[model samples]
Target: MRGFLASSIGVTCAAALALPLTLPSSGARAVTPATQSPAQRSAESVPGSTQSLPLISFGSDRSQGGGASREQGLHQREVKPFSLVGVIWDNPDDELNGSVQVRTRASGTGTWTAWQPVETHNHEHAADPDAEERASGRIRGSTAPLWVGDSDGVEIRVRGEAAEQRSDPALHRGEAAQHSGDAVEHRASAGSPAAAGQALPAGLRLELVDPGAEPPPQGSRPKGAPEALTAETAAASAVNADLAPLGADAIPPLSKKKTESDLIAARGGPEEAAGKARPYVGPRPRIITRKGWGANEKLREKKFAYTRTVKAAFVHHSASGNNYRCSQAGSVLRSIYRYHVKSSGWRDFGYNFAVDKCGNIYEGRAGGVAKPVLGAHTLGFNTNSTGIAVLGSFGYSNPPAAAVNAIARLTAWKLGLYGANPRGSTYLRSGGGNLYTKGKNVRLHVISGHRDGFATECPGIRLYKKLGKARSTSARLQGR
Candidate 1:
């Protein structure tokens, strides 16, 4: 993802006179899906609920144009319940170029929608460092996943091409034209409307995750997990039947305790605190930790590291698919955590925190939710910023109001912790990348979309439009 000054297109929502004014609640009910009461397992794990569907690797890996790379895979002729779709491919050197096209049987009509394009310019959307461990394995590149609603039948074709071969006119005029068009379309896709129909790509392994058929009963959790529910988790996972927006404060605040910089903060005291960076506000959002989601911490090469101050919040949409229930949010984080570390070859998951469609916020890439745990998100701007990834791709689809409000709430507390206004401006020295050359001091809004820093279509155009709302709401929450 390239970063900086790529103006965001604004989105407006008009409130009709007939409609009542809606305000976010000061608090929300949370859910603790950590333990599945037997009843939940029995109720949710019904006749046909959870199942793994694998992608069929097509033609063998072959060299295209001398030493160029190309790979393909296919998934067809099967029926299974699933909400999300993703593509994974081995690209250790980050030289693989690929595309995917998919059509799913619509849950409503049982008919398939036209093949839609799953934005594939996800190459720059990561902090792909040249680490030794990363070079030694089956590292891969993936398209930002697509949400195809509830679908029983799906078809996918993936194709990968070498980076250098992108400009090879000798390959074929059609191929040349395709690359040319790709560049043009990508440049103009900023908050652009989705085309009536689009075709996916081929080249990587595809994954489909099912969120189960029904949500578990509240507090009616199965036995053995625990005899009680915390005010935090219970509220974070509550589902809104009407899909109304909730307050950013829906997530409970974290416990006040020693954080990653405890010793440093202690040494500084009140006088020192006043001299150094601005601290955030009290009553932080309850962030679901890596341990909470069962992370294999040892899988990473090193322990956590910290940046200076969190001057800005870069909003991003986790390239993962959008088909998820608040209950399955745990599974989504676990899979992404493993994939980011073991599969994508990063130290940990990229985003600092992840927000599900149902509005549950999960803590990501642990250091200290309160600490500036530098993440791999937004490439050049990782330092001095906290990345909040709303789970699911929002490129073509409109994000739920609940998700939007969650971003506001998380940012409201996190950004306020540093005594920064959610809607203010801050400057960060670029670490150097495609968007702004390294070392360039970039001025940005306190709350910015990922594309604002990177050239890639991150945080997605649809989600980008809501940044304005998030900023305003977050600022208001902070008493602006």
Candidate 2:
């Protein structure tokens, strides 16, 4: 009853059917067919003996080169001398599930080997009692070694029901049929060590391999995932689409309005023709006077005389209270002076003059001197420009119409005295050059905000927008 199964290696035991067997007394036993069941008879005829019933052997007279092999009952096979190895289980019934252990030996003549475990389970019944049932059923599981050296090979072993029993009527009859799952193939390859250490160079060749099937769906994206849409990218894409139609060099020019004549034409003629002009104005700037020359008599008595004329003007806001009433405005000015002198430790008020919402001006720091006083307003320009403190904060509130008018008239008066023309536009601190010359001898009139001179947003965006209008009005008043 004994028979031999031919394999790539050599002759191995063949399963017996409807037969008996008798064991031989020497060398490898070949069981007699009459005395044993076909299964038992086939077991004895195997080269490695029944104890090693399922054995993996290298081909006869083949030089596998220092390879190793092991047989463990019907459940395990071990192979060596190979570096990259993996197992493939060809389950016809398709019920494959289990934990797998993989071991590998590094390259070189070194013996430091490591083992890691990976588990695979059926996604549908993973959490139920059926998991264990499926593990013990007709399903077959196998493990194969993965090697990573010059030569790669694997040794595979199977567990659970033997392949011969797969066709037994007793195992399948009268039982609910189970569908065979898809075949599971596990593979590993020896990757280049250099590839793992650094990024591949640009223009490297790559092969695109198609993944066979789709996996089951998972839930929503996790929190804190990056946004897929970006404004810059979207805008760039739109610009690219537009460029395809326009042939490049289609970028528009910069001017929003052509000129003053063009703006006037759009508005339908001059203000005088349209009867929208207001009455011609005369100078009505408020001025305060005090009769004092050098240091006071008290300072003379104390033997210290300091005489300094007002050479520059500084501008600021009260930043407290609205509409600049005389009493409240005066008090705010006093508080500012005290804060500057006591807290900031300055000589006197930071400004030489202050203007209220009522168009009233108050004398401060310097009183009745005709000379221009130096003030702390426009950083470098403060050496020459006079400081004028307007009564209320203009950051949020619009400058009152009266206040704007007064600023224009006052600037005109100052321009006349300084022999400067308000027509030319000069950036603050553009010293000495005749930025605007009426004939050929006029001086430059510089007007700008705190931020323009230094680096602060004191006058605020709302108020700073008025500078252009103020300049135009001042120029007209100065007969520029």
Candidate 3:
């Protein structure tokens, strides 16, 4: 393990890009079953080529032995132009509060983009918020990674609020209260002691990811290829090939379903419909399972919760820049998974499902894909709504057609299970947030953008614009 040393370490660019990696590619990033060697698949994969940077601690401990821990920042460094970055804290216990944010500059002299906040409250996004796996000595708490586009020079700062824990007496009072059931619940919900005192974080880390150049094309091994090349590698390549970047056509839409109203009308009004039953369009969409995306379920604590039925599908954009290749989608998902649970302090991945740019769909949030698994995507609306985040930022970039269709198909199938109309509206009682303050019943389109229910510019302007289409297509697919 690296010591908690606050210093800059220069690393070779090659070494930084060499971690075991993966990103899957297939038709529309879809996987076609095939025999393959895991090693070969592993070689061609890995997302967000990264380098970890140490942070300098700040603040003077006010209360006990060494006072409260202070914050940390990274010295500016020159790196390969890249899009995504993340921050990590050395301590997992409740010692850090505040947030982690960063800014970057173009390596060739372009100006720096505004400092962006890395999501810190992502614990709710994990399958298990308090999983002991999160306490792994090999890992530390981290910030939800952000997509920054291509930038070379980067600087990071992790400042936290230390107001409440300034004195040991006050801090001790908190410790004394830890045994009460109320305190236990409080600790369970808000584990960050840093947040309790309103103090900044200390012993921090910054992670930079460069998706890197595309992999070498795979073809039959040369006659004189090294002995290391084997038939298993060929099989692996075939299995992983689907993960390659694909056009929108790779993922075909399911046949349309007849609308509930259309069915009623077709049966000659409510009187006739009362004696008839609805038709099943088909089985649910083929969800790329957690195993398909290589999620480590053991990393999560085993607890489950549920809402009755999902009433809405809130769209979102990953914001982690479009720096990834479709093949690298697996790695990207894993990074977000670990970051959400370990860094953000969420229960599981915030979304119920996720779509890659190539249009491949993956199950998220541990619960059954068709269940009303409450999420943390839209602050006041997670309970009855499913969150589906596209894998890349789309504020300015045009979201791929395949991704949009994937959302429609997913919602159509999932919502159809609950008999929800894609081209309709539903009311979700607000838990709390700017869009629907606590207890307010917010009515939203079945397929709404994250921005519709929250103040965030989530789902991005470009992607948000596509929700309308996704809704229509999803409805059509449901036979409406």
Q: List model 1 lDDT by residue over 336-429, tens digit each.
A: 6655655455666778888989777777764445556567788678878889989888767999999999898788777765667887787887
- Model 3 has an lDDT value of 0.56
Residue 141 miss distance in model 2 (angstroms) = 82
Candidate 1: count the clashes: 43
Where in model 3 is the C-alpha error above 4 Å? 1-54, 57-72, 76-84, 88-143, 147-275, 280-283
Q: On residues 286-328, what C-alpha lDDT tens digit does candidate 3 reach at each position?
A: 5665545655444443443455556778888876667678877
Q: RMSDs, each prediction? A: 13.1, 47.4, 13.5
Query: Which regions in candidate 2 have their CA more than 4 angstroms from the true location?
Result: 1-284, 289-315, 321-324, 367-369, 426-445
Full-model lDDT, candidate 1: 0.56
TM-scores, all models, native as reference: 0.61, 0.33, 0.56
Ranking by TM-score: 1, 3, 2
